[model samples]
Target: MVLIGSHAYGKLPDLPAVAQNLTGLAGALRHPSVWGLPDSHCTVLDQPESAQQALDALHAQAPLATDTLIVYYAGHGLVDPYTDELYLALPASEQGRPDTALRYEYVRRAVLDPAVTARRKVVVLDSCYSGRALIGEMGAGDHVTAQALIDGTCLLTSTAETRKALSFPGERYTAFTGELIGILVGGIPEGPELLDMDTIYREAHARLAAKGRPQPQQRNRNAGGLIVLARNRAHPHSQAVGAPSDPTLTRLAPRTVPLLRRVSRRSLLVGAAVGTAGLGGAGLGIRQLLLAGEKDAGGGVGSAPSHRTTSPPAAAPSASASSSPTPTTPPTTQTSSPGGGAPRKALKPGEVAWRKKIPATDDASDVLLVDDVLVLNLDGTLHGYDRASGERRWTLRHDAPFARRLSGAAVGSGVLCIEDENMFLQGVDIRRGTKRWGFRLATEVDALDAMPPCVRGGIVYAARTGASLYALDLATGKKRWSYSPTGGVGANPTVNDTVVCVGVLDPTGNDVCAVDLRSGREKWREEFGLIEYLAVDNQCVYTCAMGTLTGLDLATREERWSQPGVRRDPTTDLQPLTLAGGVLYTTTVDGLLTARDPWTGTVRWRFNVRYGERFATWGQWSSGGGATPIIDGQTVYLGSLAYLALPDEAAFREKNRATHFVHAVDAATGTERWHFEAGGATGTTAVDATTVYVASSDGYLYGLAR
Candidate 1:
């Protein structure tokens, strides 16, 4: 048996789901009736080249026909649009280039070719582009002799080439793998002894379609006799499709939410470290704090926003703290009620102006709003649409020539800076979406996928994933200077005129270090936890992994206030803080949309946005609170849906799992002004003056009038 996957990717964000898929299948195959937990014969490969080596060795060492070879692979599977070929990436493999990835032909020759002696062969693919393997190359019908057809050869693919395999938020395995494991453990209708290869594929396909997921399928090859895989270990009386997953076998980790937005340079989860230390060891009980107006540096005894320009941070309506609050008394949910002073003008999220649906695409980044254009990266192309009309404006196929993955543009300095996973940075004219300048990395240096570059003052401040930091001229893509640190580099730099703040780590502890933007000299380094995200405008660093949000002085690097464990319900933590229109917003695992004071960590208001009472049947679906909140001018929007994270992993991903909603709340007052009850709601949100755009996991991008 061969199990291969690449989870520790260097040039791209690591997919934790890969690890889940690997371990889940490995456990299922070891059932007593299957392989009987035979550790000696199984081979596991994590690297791309290593998998090829193992396959080549198999051909040289072809042995007996009794040997049944089983193959399982889960990773980033890319289909070259130019060549119409599919390639599977290894840990060190590059995205677009075929040389770095394992080609499908190699897999076909190693496993499907008659020259190899294995009589029984089965291949299972669980990936985005996995279905491509069963197309033209492996077409059915007459091919060669009847002797080859008699051999019990089978192939199972996760989804059609056009659809993407969905990931569970906190479950151990993906939707496809989880269902497959259940069937192998539980006996079929005819019992485990009489189960055939076709039954396995058909059962998995039914399970996927039932969950509103892309249907997995099998072709003409599943025509063998009964192939007993394992003894039925599930309860004899129970006949549920998913009743076989052993509770003991389900491995659980600290529940984590994967951020899908592209506003930051690197993914917030990967670019951070969840250390034991909390906010430099400052422990403050934030559970009972009431909503209070934001106080400036001197007013609240905390550091103020950097005074680089003459203008100060926007003033919010002052809200005084409430008297001793009991646990039962939640924060007030009044829309026009400003706590301490006169009511502020509540934002009116006007009715829908227009709603349109965009074509479903692959690996899409969050919808971006730049210069009145809504931009989203799909497959190998970047599409721009009119923010109001939803009309196609321009399509940027810059990466089409190389087929490399394009980083969403970081717009500033009249240019849009894009970083490719292959270590090439390009500057494009923002309005025209035309490439103006490009810079390629030297051979000796490696690019970091977790540390994205930030553009400020016509300069780009970026850190290499495994090396040092560099500042580049945005207009010309020229390196200004480089600073080599001792260890790995992190992303989301908070750049002010005086210094650029970066998160760095070494053997000791995680730290937030400051460097002089002009000189590239270290100004100060503070012992702090690895930062999940840094808000530069307010000099705030948040570690969502630890549930701590700390404010810092950009000039002095001193701690203003630290709010550790500031979540409404402790089931899951808040997403990294998002700042817009002078207000900070984040969602909680318990379905609370929270607005906080920028400097003092005071609660502005909290709104409960659960799916419904019917959803209460499943206690908590998903890491329910991980959906991100978007701030559009004076309004805050959230996509709220329930996902069954426990009990059953695939319960919530249904064609109709229950009704879902996208809410528009007044930023200042935490009151729902308007809402759109679109089912299968997600955090993929972007807004303009006229409309709001949202994407559902069910392959639909909806445009709603605001």
Candidate 2:
């Protein structure tokens, strides 16, 4: 195995992530549970001075490989404008000069040389335009010898022909290689015992798509994808691991869980710590919560409805005590509705409207409100219920035999868009509860899901998750136009009346740009840092990146204001901005709901979640457990998703069930109006004039009303 990375570019933008990629990938390949390659077998070339250094390394290593020969490179990829051939960039390479770099043809010839006796060969490229390597014939054949074929070769590239590879500013590794290392180390639970090339590529592709990064390109010849690369470390009976004696290799850490969307991110049932802590801790907590569910069914603290019934029963009145700390001022009573609705007789704030116990998995999307129906996406099924009565109205399940899960969904303009496991975005008429049109995004499917699409103004703005941003007409489901940035779409598109803004991932650094809504032309672009979240309002565009919250004026397209410290901890802190009623609502890693004036960046008020003695543990406070604040009328519904912490290891083992709460706070004053406890951690919430719908991980959907 030969690993090569060039970080020092003379004139072009340098990639600092290359060095980290080399170290991390080498470790994953040497891990006992993975490839277990001997120390002498793996060769790493970091910042090679010239093409000869790399060529010499490959020549020296390829002949000794008896089973497989793997060649991996990470750096800038240049295309010769004259011949349009790919070149692997090095330290002396420039932006437009491809002659200074190493021609990729030489590398290909070395992989297919007759002297090398390796049965299977793999070439992985992590550079811009690396996919151009797949243009020509791969294996050699001869009619004189009855068309004898050479060994099959598999090639994986970081980006397509026109796209640039991405390396976020603060990320430890390049976006493409980071995901690859993650799978090799963490291992796919449902994958086969031996991880093959195709399985690895598909898993990495889906994960990148889910985060709105660039999708990779792969080319396999003569069953090349079937070549086994490593053993699945996630399997139970894999290997009894041993410590590595090599000083250069360290055990690779698990990948950080992504921020899905504003709604899905905040609606997650568990925290990042639990998500990365492995299945043991999470399983123990879930088991304890299952017992709590039984207690709720038997009339203990929680409210459980009849099993799988359409109209189960109305929940009992919830307690009115404040679960958080006491506020400086009490919430004032309001008689008139602010958002254009007549005031009716108001019930107690925590009172429940209805509760239904459905067979929902923990991976539920945000509860969606569409006209007269409430739509909820479970694993592979979509269930629609009557908004007023909580009775089941319709159901739709994905029909794909292999990719049966639904990744994400969006509802607006009387239409619903659901992306199935097959990467097909299906448009459903929400009023009639039937499929309107279906558009297949990709030909492949896997366990990874995508971010929900954005629907507005008779158009559905969707992304191919790292490839292109597309605008689809709602009426016809035909694509209006697509804009492919230098990198790929980094996140879901944020649209407005005049322009649509998106975060574009790149090897240099991610960018946030605005495009004309009608023409799909580039209006303006601001080269920003790694974009965590993107949002737009009538007057300005807001983005959170590198712990700073920046606002750009819409008409002037200039920086309005910038505020740092929004995200103190990059890994765990998620600063999702919600713009409503001219106020920018953001959450902090320390569990504070901060309301800011969007124009001047002035602080309006802040609502803090206090973890009392019962929930206290060692660590900083959480970012409201990834739940973004949802504002409706004059009320803001905030689901404080559970962050599990215990006083000791014994308590963490025995009593792992942590309770979550939904607090209805005064939108204007940031004071808690009421709070309701759930059987398990709460996710995102959807609210109407009269009721608030909450999705809980404990397999119940509660309709809380005033």
Candidate 3:
């Protein structure tokens, strides 16, 4: 473990709390209940004179540890004005002179060196714009964030890429580090005996949010959370009377520790009820099992305060529902209701239904409807709420370390399917918040990644990137059949009753592969430049690649129509194509909303959705936000990323701030009706008969009504 802190600077204001941050964190790390590393093992680099000096100490100490390597930095982080690269300030470092300071790239290169053979690596950055390290080369002052996660490592940052790290006037240490150390020494009550990186980060994030501080961000890969950092001293066994030696107080081991399975009270009760005859007496058996599980699991079924719900008020006529002539209904399969039943009433222009505050960081985490329950995944936990009242119904936690934007989710057969942190496809009961089954998707790096899983009938189709596609039973999670194309399935599959169409990533370029839905037999394969989005119906399969949209016949396997200059980003645009009401809705090359004919790529109309801009900057109003439009009745709802221009000095210090807004537009003429402003950037959304649920980056889930 190497702890570095720089508290002095030449031009910029000094950060005095960095010194205490190092001292406090070191003490917590050496505690008997924590890591308990010896004095000789822990290295302290206080106020290193040069970047090379810090790199030398880090490289020297990193290679000796065979178990885990922990490197933490607490200092003023500087960003280059020209390149937007990050730097760590030293004692003699100036604000704008990055050459005189320590380049974070040098430190990253050292920690990622091949000579460092530590079993696990963890890096903690408690500085401004530290989150930039999570990505590859960044854009020149763009407020948009991207992910290029490092494999086999865990990274925790103090703030977002465009935000500043906070420290109050008289605090002992920095905000993020202080909260982290408190959790390490104090131990999380009702938590597991072993504290992993995921658990620690979740607790600290919640604590800092409650205190109105900037929330932190984390990224993990290759099971980095399995590397246990500290032992929980607050477990009941640690204070038990006349008990055996408490394992929670033991010293750290050199190998990874398996996470204990958390058995909820509901599961234990069901288990007892199923085998009451074999358990001798129902009363005594139930009591004992409940006691055992409740000791560690604090919140579960029948916990009134934790899982509270309020009845939704009686429905009334929408005041803003102006009586317009009902338009002709199209003969399309897509409907707003999950059951494909009657369509719901569209939200009117400039109407507000309900607004809620929620912790929604992952843009890939979608809003799904399972009957009357609204399901959303925040961080690593799955949340179910009442769709009508916005009341939380239940929550189920995943043991994995980090949440990924590409970890897609789907809902069908009354079950919600999602890829967890361990790369396992888990089928969860959307209404009850219980796990039905889990299926392993990959076992090695060759089968490392997967696109979002799509469900049809009783079988769920999942594609492992560059690997084979598997059809699993939604109820049992057992593999029904597996299909491996020459090139693996690259994008999410679109399925109808008979066939499943997937975008294939070949060695040379990309292709579109179609397979039989039930038998997993290859039907046909064709070449496309690089698929960005895909959709399917009974007659044709639509694919967007290289800024072009093409329609392929289902039977002939020939191109039906081709149109160029279709704009999309596969990493962020989860649902770019919406086929409904006999019309296709998509974004154009210039980020304008356009209604097109699916059979013949002819645009009906285009509407400019970019409205507000705080500055007259380049590309500020060029493209619309990336969120896909949600269509119901006659209105299309879309969320966008808006910019906020700060004062001249503040804008120079930080490039710009980005906010979010949701707009309602007419589906017929492509005219924007109403738009509701949100506190942060928006993600995917789900709608009901009268309510539209939206997920935002400002830690809020909103429900807009007419």
Model 1 spans > 4 angstroms off: 1-351, 362-365, 398-409, 439-448, 538-545, 567-574, 588-592, 611-628, 639-660, 679-681, 695-701
Task: Score candidate 3 by lDDT.
Answer: 0.57
Clashes of each: 10, 4, 3
TM-score of 1: 0.45
Candidate 3, residues 556-607: lDDT per residue as tens digits? 9889999863333332232356554345667532345666767777776666
Worst 10 residues of 2 by lDDT: 270-279
Q: Residues 307-407, candidate 2: write the lDDT tens digits.
A: 10011111111111121123332211112222222333334556565577766454433466654567766556777877656667888765742122121
Ranking by lDDT: 2, 3, 1
- The alpha-carbon lDDT assigned to residue 648 of candidate 3 equals 33
Q: Please give the lDDT score at residue 388 for candidate 1.
A: 39
Pull out the clashing pairs in model 2: 266-626, 266-627, 267-684, 347-706
TM-score of each: 0.45, 0.47, 0.47
Per-model CA lDDT versus the true structure: 0.49, 0.58, 0.57
